[model samples]
Target: MGIVSNRQNASDYDDDMKRAKAAGIDAFALNIGTDAYTDTQLAYAYQSAADNDMKVFISFDFNWWSASQGSEVGAKVAKYANLPAQLMVDGKVFVSSFTGDGVDISAIRSAAGCNVFFAPNFHPGQGDFGDVEAALNWVAWSNDGNNKAPTLAKQLSVSSGDNTYKAALDGKPYIAPVSPWFSTHFGSEVSYSKNWVFPSDLLWYNRWREILQESPRFVEIITWNDYGESHYVGPLSSPHTDDGASKWVMDMPHNGWLDMAKPFIAAYKAGSKFPIEFLDEEKLVYWYRPTPKDVDCDATDTTMQGNPNNSSGNFFRGRPDGADTMADEVFLVTMLKEPATVEVQSGDISVTLEASPGVWSHSVPMGVGAQSFKVTRGGKTVDSLSGTSLRDITDTCPCGIYNFNAYVGTLPAEAAIDQLQPDGLTMLSQGLQVACPTNTLGASSASAT
Candidate 1:
């Protein structure tokens, strides 16, 4: 998971670690820039990880550092190499990066004065770094063959990037990335200019299945709290939204996505195929953009062209490349203990599908108004989400700004009965009743539909 450096205290890191641990996450890759609070935040994060029995490693943001700063990067890594929470591999420090392809890895290891397992993202041809022990492929989304300048008109093969990276690794470890969605609305207002959306209908469900099939050495979810890009799978922590991203992220909650990922994560670690066996509770997780794609806004941010820093901007204006590629539909995934009938209602459009016992994904065209969902087994309503529970899809842009961000919701919305404790952590109320009946389904019988 990618953790931004905007935390206030150790407690903030503790809360995130606890939640991540509960989700079966092992470590957090702290993405830090050259901000003044980098050291302070890293200290808090390392301490919290140690307290929570979680591992952590630093991932330098090359946007702030240049190829000449290899020594500075190595010094930072060495400073925390001996920390209790630092992630170590084979008695060597585990180091990674977002983008620092041309940097000298030998200089980094020489400065650190220790063995280093380097796994930096060297996209657009994994550079000639013979010292790289492993490689990290950061292209998590489906796109054209071009990684630097993707053609919006071409549809690339699914998991094509992973295949290429595996071939390039030549039997070495390849860290594959998996992300549910991607859409940013930043412009020249911020130091960078980025605005675009990949075609991500059912991406969250599809990518997990792909991971189970490929079983890469390591799988890093693209982000945990990248609100500006709208792919955050963590809870909405207001304190971490200081990057002017709250405008679109405040009311949007993506905890349901994590809940849906629990079973898949467990199965992946267990070396199992497409998981169908851990359906202890029935869950119906759904996600969709609040506004229709056809809606017009006063400003349209330009689509990103490879590097955000080098791209020109028009303040808050320009149309995204794949805007027209997005389907006007509500994507959903269901985890059931038995065969059931699922129904999705988006405004006046309702679509029903019969799902067998296991995990299933389906989508229905979106409509204007409140959305609702339900699961029925043997002609009885087992689980459901009323229309009043979620925000209604509208024709106008939210707050007059284009928000391609997705709002995810579950059948038994956990937020409805979540209680904030004295320690500033939210927990589900104990012994809460759920609409879906529980069952003891064996993992061997679990299958994906």
Candidate 2:
């Protein structure tokens, strides 16, 4: 998991580490910038990781760094190279970066004066990897044909960037990135220009399946807490929202995606082809934009064109690219212990499918009104979500801006509940355990076990 440095205390880092560890994450890549508090935050993170029995490594953010400051970067990394929580690969310190493609690797290694395993996120064709032990592909989303300020257009395929990086490494270790969604909104108020939404329909499920198939040496979830981009999977914390991201992040909880990922993480570690066997309980995780696709936003917002650099003079105040392609649909994934009927109803439109004892995903056209979901077996309700607990789908945007962010929820809504303990791990409830019959059933079976 990628954790941006905004933590306030050791307890804050401890809380995040415990939750990540419970989710089957092996380590935390602390994303550090040149902020003055970075050193203090790193100290807290390292000590917290050790207390939680988790591993950590430093990931330098190049936005505030320059290639000429290789010595400074090396010195910062050397400071924590010997920490007990430091992640090591083959007895060497494991270090990474966000976008230091031009940084001198030899200079960093020489200054650190230790064996280093460098795996920076140098985009394809941008940096030399001769001295690198591994490479990390940072392009987690698919884009339109335009390279500069490309629109987040197609469903990401492994062959798009993963295959290219793997081929370039020529058998070196590759760390692949997996994320649920990506949406960023910023105007002239912020110095950097960013406003776009990637096509994320069922991306959480699709990407995990791709990871199990490709089986890279390692996988990094795009972020654990990056509210500004609206892809955070961690519970929203107020202290970390000083960057003006709370406008879009508050009240938008994504923990449901983490609940859906538990089984996938277990399957990946076990080298299983499918995550069905790893699923211990039945669950129905669903997500959708609170507003319909046709809603208009304030005219002052500039739509993201090709290249955020704005060198092509494509910048103008309007709707974002790929916004029109976003399907007005509700996406859901179901894990079942027996054959059951899954139904999704939005307003007057209802869609139903007979799902078997396995992991399955489907989407239905979204309707404006109260959203509801249910699972039935032998004419009896097994699990469901209804009433006012869920946010209603409205025709108007809540934020008054082009809010493309999603609000995720689960069917057995209580199944998503988690309580953190003093030990830093969550006390999970065994809510949806079901007993299956002896007879093995196929996907065609419509009867309950």
Candidate 3:
């Protein structure tokens, strides 16, 4: 499901539908607030989806809707209930809400002629909507790095609980969620930043595998365009751009995550192992936190206060998990069609692994030097990628704020080896460098065109 902006116009909807369809998605779950301006925008989106031969649904934001507006909400919903682009399931129009506990689902459905297929994410266990047709839980955070085994175990626990929730429906559907990463510092208005992360190192791969195993009727990628959350897998262009958030994200591209998701999407739908193909050339895509755990690179910048609404786990709970203290390491996913030795060079701590056909990932300790990678087979280099030069330690945040955005960079497939030149050095005597100096202010603040 695509998380779309209600500010989008007809043309923007057309373009986003085209992109989402190309990526094997079927619908855009328009995340809407209770505003007349948004109501008009939703109309344009519905018409655009109908024009593009796609489906659209509404995800009412409870944060924006009051409990007393039930009938009004229903009337507003019924306006688009019969639209051609409105997603229908088993003769009912599909509708879901974000934390819709206060808003009475049954009352809204009754007002809408009781013909809605309701499946709202009501946070968990606040109250049960036993009459709703389906169940949805958007709890897709594991917040761990590439330690695959433990990550899978944690996800399985979620899936296990979801399975029980599904069983309560007695054969109705469950919308499972999957995400690539989460870091909302640069774009949040809340008191504290959402610095938690689920490693993108094979994240798309692992999440899809787990989702397929759980066999949910529907799967929603956590976001297609919530750029502030830093989990967006769609383009960094306009209409689908920032919702009054940071400009830092406009330059930090996660489009590579979409490129990495194609195979997984196909496999999940077909219920078979879809051989991952190279959408682009064989490359190593990577990202990492610029500042590590509890490391203050900028003393002048006041660090954010704790989020009172933050979930109780790992980094959000003010307690570090086992992997929480793990240094900020470069996470790389290598796609190769043949066996090759992929080397991660950070300072003198160079580690090489024999990567066979398909995608495999590795993490190397980041240090006070440039980071780079090379793929070689039979003593000949096949392809190589040069990363951005690491920044120096500083005593101030570039934007004078606690910046939590990941510094994402890529060594393009066609990049010259000389482009990745790093200072020759030996093993890092310490672990991964926890914090790197922030880049110049506004360096990552380019607005989308």
Q: What C-alpha lDDT, on a 0 to 100 scale, does residue 119 get in candidate 2? A: 93
Could you estimate the TM-score for every candidate?
A: 0.86, 0.86, 0.75
lDDT of 2 by residue, 1-449 (tens): 12334456777777778889998998989887788778888898899999999999999888778877788888988999999999999899999999898898888998888999999998767777777899888777766534212344534454478987887788899999999888766545445556667777788889999999988888999878777677878876423523445434544678889888988999999999788888887888888887787887654233322334444333334455557657899888887778888778887788888887777888999899888887778888774432222567788655445667887787667434332122211111101012211111112332222
Candidate 1 structure quality by residue, lDDT tens digits, 224-260: 8787778888777523524445445645778888888
Candidate order (TM-score): 1, 2, 3
Task: Tell me model 1's lDDT, rounded to 2 decimals.
Answer: 0.72
Instruction: State each model's CA lDDT, in order.
Output: 0.72, 0.72, 0.59
Clashing pairs in 2: 148-307, 149-306, 149-307
The TM-score, computed over Cα atoms with residue i paired to residue i, of candidate 3 is: 0.75
Comparing 2 and 3 by TM-score, which wins?
2
Q: Give stretches of model 3 more than 4 Å off.
A: 1-8, 143-157, 160-164, 167-170, 186-203, 240-244, 247-250, 274-283, 302-327, 384-401, 409-449
lDDT of candidate model 3 versus the reference: 0.59
